[model samples]
Target: MSDEKSKLLQMVRDGKISVEEGAELLDAMDEPGTKPSGAEKELKDRFLRVHVDSAEAKVNVNIPLSLLKVASRLGNMIAGLIPGEARREMAGRGLDLSKIDFEELMNLINQGLEDGKLVDVDIEDPVKGRIRVEIYVE
Candidate 1:
């Protein structure tokens, strides 16, 4: 591997920057004449944040998409944040949290996917009462 690429990955692994930042830096390296400036870089580093609110639980997950290798682990952690009752409701609706492919999602984002509110679901849970689940890439 090229030293630049290795260094970029190391910075990501060390939590010095997010995977998106590392990828942008590597892309700048490849071009050798262009770099994401100010506003562009600011937009590139936006996060995918999840918030689940309910009478019984309030969960907030901020995903920086750091290191593609750990995307699944992050997904799992996010899934773990949802309360049991809400998880069951989500599963019954055919939305299996365990199967979410965060790596693919990251690819789409890197390719210049527009950022905005991605998901917002509000429901009445039997145990949790009024519940709302929100997922957004912003």
Candidate 2:
């Protein structure tokens, strides 16, 4: 174990910190100049990654939560840019973008990351073949 990890474990044993806090602290400690394991790196990332793979095509996207926050703010600022008719049209089609709670969604994602939850989705379309999508904090 790394010295930092060992120290954290020791702290746990000494009752200086709870096991859960020690685990969180140990997870936050990554040695400089050392490559982190995939899961380890993902735990520390501020972006959410969506990776899709299939026989026909592959797509990898990394979306920063910070960018989403900025976009949400910008969208609020430009809400009036969309014509009333267009907004009503979109709402009629059941596509109401204004109803999305971006902040709440981000908060849920952040909580999931903190809880070390992994979500994997797989789809098989007759025409598209097989596709695997992995959404995780990274």
Candidate 3:
């Protein structure tokens, strides 16, 4: 570890600096002009990941949080990419992608969402076996 970081950790451990303050100092050393209070690194470096697994197939998708700045366009592309059968299934489950406010969701996520799963869906398909869909922020 760098001496600066070691000293910062010691300060935090000694109660001379709060965790948030120490984090901000670290952020300042890493990036000169990053937003603070835990949102700095998240907004710039976090990602949203989607994993779909089934007996027949497995798919993994990773979208950087920075790219979500264009959420509206991305949302349309994402909605359009779903297969018709999957779209219909989602619609039947009252999850119409068209009605989702992706921009707003992105904004809310930017405000504070840390690393965690946002959605987890399990479906029992007659032929496809157990299918699982997981969406998480990382």
Candidate 4:
């Protein structure tokens, strides 16, 4: 439990505030734009992450979506860092990094995230490896 929430509950337990008022206070704490702490910090905006692990290999990638806007400037430098086999594996799963238009994709992701998570993909490929990809709005 968050410190604020715990304090609110304590207020109620100590008879310092009515249950209804405590409820209201708790509700207000959740208002958007409020600074988060503890576990809530984990829910903050973060780089898109891709994770892969297997007995034979492991991979971890963190990409800031904003960087994609400047990817053209970086040319193939970013892609070059990834192994060809991994790139091929991603392509086989219908995710062709080379073909993606980052700007357009970011727009679409933004639209999808207005409601909730935009994409959460988990795949276990017998030939390639295990993979988890998560994309979300901050």
Candidate that scores best on TM-score: 1
- Model 4 Cα lDDT, one tens digit per residue, 1-138: 865466457746865445875675566557664445353343334444444444444544444343333323222433433445555666666765555575675556455535334445556667656644443444
What TM-score do all the candidates reach, one by one?
0.61, 0.38, 0.56, 0.39
In model 1, the runs with Cα more than 4 Å from the true position are: 1-44, 66-69
Note the Cα lDDT for every prediction shown: 0.65, 0.48, 0.60, 0.49
Winner of 2 and 3 under TM-score: 3
Clashing pairs in 3: none
Give me the overall lDDT of model 4: 0.49
Give a tens-digit lDDT track for model 3, residues 54-131.
Answer: 665565655556544433344544555454455567677777655667567776786675689877667777765676
Q: Which is better, 3 or 4, measured by lDDT?
A: 3
Candidate 2 local accuracy as lDDT?
0.48
User: For residue 63, what is the lDDT in candidate 3?
Assistant: 54
Ranking by TM-score: 1, 3, 4, 2
lDDT of 1 by residue, 3-34 (tens): 43675577578764568866765665566433
User: Which 10 consecutive positions of candidate 3 have the poorest summed lDDT?
Assistant: 32-41
The model with the greatest lDDT is: 1
Off by over 4 Å in 4: 1-44, 54-57, 71-84, 114-138
Q: Estimate, for each residue in 1-138, the C-alpha lDDT of model 2 and write its tens digit.
A: 654355446646865445765565454444343334443343333655545566654545443443333224333322233334444544555645455565675667555635332445465556656656454655
